[model samples]
Target chain A: MTPTITAFETSPDRGQGLARDMRVRWSLEEVRQPYEVRLVSFAAMKEPAHLARHPFGQIPTYEEGELVLFESGAIVLHIAQRHAGLLPDDANARARAVAWMFAAVNTIEPPILDLQNAKFQEGDKPWAAERMPLVLDRIRQRAGQLSERLDDADWLDGAFSAGDLMMIGVLRRLRPSGLLDEYPNLAAYVARGEARPAFKRAFDAQLAVFTSRQPAAG
Target chain B: MTPTITAFETSPDRGQGLARDMRVRWSLEEVRQPYEVRLVSFAAMKEPAHLARHPFGQIPTYEEGELVLFESGAIVLHIAQRHAGLLPDDANARARAVAWMFAAVNTIEPPILDLQNAKFQEGDKPWAAERMPLVLDRIRQRAGQLSERLDDADWLDGAFSAGDLMMIGVLRRLRPSGLLDEYPNLAAYVARGEARPAFKRAFDAQLAVFTSRQPAAG
Candidate 1:
């Protein structure tokens, strides 16, 4: 069965593929699986029906037959587990890859999210200016540790499994903050992830959603 | 062979079981697995050897034979997958359970971590007092949503899968904040988890570590 995943009717990221839905879409594309997207407005996302699908009332929920799953990491993992491409055949390597997936969101993404909260959520607050550096420093610290770990590796682990998919997805959010550019190899790593044919397809799919919603430019 | 996991020689939480190691330990206890602990001090955690095992240089790295894993969520999930007791036998149900695990860490814990950053990390900052409400409000929003979803349900989904283990573990962090108390059902939910025999064993084991390190109180 072709799974159906939800996305924003108009993503807050303006379809730059920074939204979490892109992770699910990218995973499906990587596994060469065709799926359907259900676009939801911000208002509709909070409604009871959507909330039942996702307790957090967020988008990018996966539904296949009786199964419904949320959280991009889980959804991607689900895809990876069921399909052959996104995980390794070796058991230990697979577990290590999953560890990187958790690291991307739990360890690395939290500080980056704080940067967003500081800029957009608390931008008007008096402390925002002074606190901005602290937030950036936190991101840099994680990024530095990550860069040191990445070194010259093409991917986080031996292969480009779901771990790289999720890590690159999380790091891509730092593009606007310019923190990613500070690490040359990390920047190259993100560039390499984007260059994947699966990633380009997923990127264009989400980008089309944004482009279609816009009025003619000329 | 017994797997070995790392913990803090002296956890910052001071034996409250708030450290991520508790999650792995609890999961092990639930599965009736015998494991060994290797504690690392703050200085040693950042050393090259520890960093080689865990790139982020944090406690609770799991080493079983040839496999080495970091991130408590991944470690617990690894334990869950290998043992029958932690994950539901049904495939779809297992996937849903994993979704809750991600929700607990990614969606719920980030705000809680932000509160920590605001208080302890920036507690001395000029705007610390004023900025706390915003931090608390973000946590409240997620907690409220979670409470509504949980309602009177004993667990996040069904049965006591790894999902509940992780969600309960994450919610336990809110104890000091008094945030968990605001949601009576959620508090009860956490209490139910703590009352489990497995949870007690894990809690006591970690608590023993703290007490052993302390000089006799006068």
Candidate 2:
């Protein structure tokens, strides 16, 4: 059975692949799992009907038969567990991989998200200029720790898994600030993720949505 | 070997279990694991030595022999995996439980954390009042989704596991906003978590720090 996931009808990021749904799409692609997307508009998302699937009126809620799930990390973990490639078979390694996944969201993504909130949401505020540095510093701290750990390693723990997939998604949000380039290795890591054939498929899929929304380019 | 975790010498939260370390402490207590705490001053946290352990200068880093880890979610997860109580033996159920942990931090906590940022970090800004509702609405959306699904379920999945523990922790932050009260079921759910003996132990441990910090009454 093909699982269905919700996404933005017209994403705020356009075709940038920074939308949360892109991670779910890329995860499905990575595991070679065929799936369907149910795009939701801003209004539809806030409605009780859509909220039933995702309490938060957000995109990328996954449903398979009776099993409904939200949160891209949770959905990706579920997919990784049900399928083969995204998690290690060894118990300890698997735990470590999952740890990396948690780290990606909790430790790393918080500041990046804060940066977004500061800019788009609070950019015009009196404290925006002063508060921006604190948020950026927080992000840089995480990036430095991550880069130090990654050093020359290909992946955070071992082979590429959902952890790398999530880390790339989180780090890619930093592209707008151009802060990711300050750490050469982390920038390369995002590039490597974008270079993945699965990621390419996922990116193209999202881009198609934006292109489809255009007035037929006549 | 007993594990060692870090905590704030003088927490900004005045020992209300709002510190990240409290999450780790709660997880350890829940699993019946014995651990030690090394309190670091704010200045020490930014020092090279502490930065090596935690680049973000955050509390609650786990050091179990050679396996040193930062990030409360990851540390809590590590303890949960090593100990028996926090996760289930069943494969599918275990995956679902782990998924909740991700949901707690990645999905639920983002808006709550943003609210904190807006109030404490950017409160003086002119746009703070205008932007606050949007963030709160975002939080309410997630709370509403979770509250409906939780309906009458005792826990997120089957029995209480790391997922619920993490979820409860995330939800508890909403108490200050009185938003959880807006959703009766979620309020009850958090109360259930607070009622746990393990949670009490962790809470008291943190509370003790605040009490000890007070000067003796003359």
Candidate 3:
């Protein structure tokens, strides 16, 4: 069964592939699995139908027959588990890959998301300017450690598993912040992930949605 | 060989079980698995040893033979995958449970952490008072949706899985915030989790460490 995942009918990022559905799409592409997309309007996403599929009423929900899942990390892992390409055959390596997936979302992504909240959510707030540095510092702290660990490696772990996929997605969010450039290797790391054929395909797919829906210029 | 995990030498939460190690401990107790603990000081966590085990320098790094893993969610899922208690036997149900784990950490915990950052990390900022309500409201938004889904259900899913374990852990952080009271059902759900015997065992274990290390009052 071709799993159906949801994306924003009109992505706030304007199809930058930052919407989480891009993660699931990238994972599916890595595994060479075909899937379908169900574009959801913001209002419809909050409605009962989408909420039932995702309690938090967010997009990038995966539904295949009876199995419905959300959270890009989980959806990516599910795809990785079912298909061999995204994880290692060795049990220990596979478990480590899963650990990196958790670290990406839990430890790494939280601070990056805070940076976003400081800008998008609290940009007008009086503290945005003052707290922005603190938030950015938090991201810098994690990036420094991650860069030290990566140390010219091609991937976070031994191979390009789901861990790299999620980490790269989180790092992509930092592209606009310019902090990623401060850590040269980490910036290169994001570049390597972006260069993958699978990533390019997924990026184009989501970008097309935004482009095709562009309002005609006056 | 028994798996070894790490914890803070003296937890800042003062045995409140807010530390990530508590999650790993609870999972072990639920699965009846015996494990060893390695206490790392704040400085030691940054040293080469612990950093080798956990790149991010956090507690709750699991080591058994050659397989080392970090991230409480990943550790819990690893325990669940290897042991019988924490995941469902059905594949679809298991996938759903994993998704809930991600939601708890990714979706639910982020807002709660924002509240913490506002208080613990940025409490003295000039805009702290004004911006706290915004952070609090963000948490309430998620709590409202979660409460509706869990209206009458015992757990997020059908049975007690790692999903509930993680969600409960994230919610426990909110007890001091008092915002949990706004959602009565969600509060009760957290209470139900606390009342579990495994949770009690885990709590006591961490609390004992804090109690033993308490500095004598003058």
List-wise, what DockQ does each model earn? 0.93, 0.44, 0.86
Tens digit of lDDT per residue, candidate 3, span A101-164? 9988998899988888888888998777878889998889999999999998999888899999
lDDT per residue (tens digit) for residues B41-159 in model 3: 99999999999999999898999999999999999999999999899999999999999899999988998988988898899989989998889998999999999999998998899
Across residues B1-218, which tens digit of lDDT does each residue of candidate 2 receive? 99999988886876668777878888899988888888889899888788777656677777877666777777777788788999999765776677788889988898898889878876887767877887898788778778877889889888999999999988888888888899988999999988999999999988888779888899
lDDT of 1 by residue, B6-42 (tens): 9999868888999999999999999999999999999
> For model 1, how does the per-residue alpha-carbon lDDT over A23-134 read when each residue is reduced to its tens digit?
9999999999999999999999999999999999998899999999999999999999999999999999999999999999999999999998998899999998998999
**Per-chain TM-score of chain B, candidate 1?**
0.99
Runs of candidate 1 with Cα error greater than 4 angstroms are none
Q: Estimate each model's TM-score.
A: 0.99, 0.86, 0.98
Error of 2 at A59 (Å): 2.1
Q: Pick the candidate with the highest lDDT.
A: 1
Question: What's the true lDDT of residue A1 in model 1?
Answer: 99
| Regions of model 3 farther than 4 Å from truth | A216-218, B216-218
lDDT value, residue A79 of candidate 2: 91
Q: Between 1 and 2, whose TM-score is larger? A: 1
RMSD of 3: 1.1
Which model scores highest in DockQ? Answer: 1
> Candidate 1 vs candidate 3: which has greater lDDT?
1
